[model samples]
Target: MAIRMHAALRRCTWLLALGWLTSLPATAALPEDPFRSPMWEYNLARYLGADAAVRHSDTVVIKTPPFAEDATQVPLTVDLSAFPHEIKEVITWVDLNPVPHLFTLRPEAAEIRTVALNFRIQQASTVRAAVRDEQGGWHVGSVHVEAAGGGCTAPSATASNPDWADSFGQVRGALFSPVGGVTGTRLKVQVMHPMDSGMVGNIPRFNIETLELRQTANQQRLASMALSESASENPLFVFDLEHDAQQSGILLLLRDNGGNLIESRMGI
Candidate 1:
């Protein structure tokens, strides 16, 4: 009698799952077809609450190439110039990655309207940038990036190095005059750390926790961004700096999940 009851429950569960799957539209957003339908409903509802609304905006642009040559270091740029003053925060993530949440940036000033970032894509996924306005509305911009294979579950290249610990928090940065329609002085920064999410084999979760960019002249903070374990190992970033700022340099301060703080300066 117990065996028969268990079998009956299993059959009912299977029927329910089948019904749910069949109820979805043919163009439904699934793991196989992420671009056809935006697969961000779960993430958006979870992070921004179920009542939050997300709409497409021309002002919020996510720029990336159609195909990424390197799945582990695809270059992306987010532009928030249209609603600069109204933007309260920006959150970026990949739709299909094992751990999707990438980072969140809260601009301390209106000058921080654009940012260039490097992150990993597990597969062909929809990368989204959601900007929260001062009035509490979320504006979304997304782009599709294709990769030949996976990135998130792959073993870290830098993590296996014997010398990784010696240079864990080492930072390198430089500033260059804007070219190719990029405004102001472009600040490029690279930090050494394996942003492991623990999804890959025996690796445990380790990532950069916080990043602060400040002007050296007045010690005034320009922006603060928070990163999650979903970020690529050895994260890289670029930001546009106001051309007429008083400083000839900018300071970089970062803290990792292990609570190690490292600071450096980049001359403009």
Candidate 2:
């Protein structure tokens, strides 16, 4: 009689556990890729990790020319103004380039609304921008660009110039009041570099590895970025910073893999 009573208790516990599991909510499925490129799955797992919680979001906007007039200097813009959550980080990459990784931007003391840069593409490819929110979810935006071949393997225009080294590491920047009645400051900066991808014969990979924007008065870093070889020869970067009177004066600092440092200042 005691043995029979123990078996009945065990059966009751098993049924209760099953019921609890069935009552739990099911996880939502990830959204399908709009572009549906073959490289989508591979690049997603490779760059964002296989276990990342990623979903396609309309709030993360990626803008680029449908047909690239200049493959080596294609312009790309990522706008995050419509994101409902606080952004933690932003990453951009080209799907089919030899060196696919483009840049990673982390906002420190600044609220980055929009970022724009020029990059090279080896061929027609899909470009992606993934924004990570405070809750550790990745919101992705993608756009397809058509281009001719040889953007990566071609020799840089700066490298062919006889006086390329004369203006190396030079920086020019300007600050403007917010445009379109927006409540922020607009910063445009250009850095002179060969940005060699080493794909061409005898050209070693030489490009800016790190860049930082800081407050000129206290040297407090507002934002930082890590760049890769896929960037254009002389990169033009545009940033939209949230309005802050205390952040009137800005400093730009850039360092390359060749141990070269460039610094410049711009005042609002």
Best by lDDT: 2
lDDT of 1 by residue, 106-222 (tens): 877426667887888888988888899878878878788888857777788988798889988888878777668655667788898888877787788788889998888777787
Choose the strongest candidate by TM-score: 2
Model 2, residue 47: what's the lDDT? 81
What's each prediction's clash count?
Answer: 0, 0
**Backbone clashes (count) for model 2:** 0
TM-score of each: 0.78, 0.87
lDDT of 2: 0.89
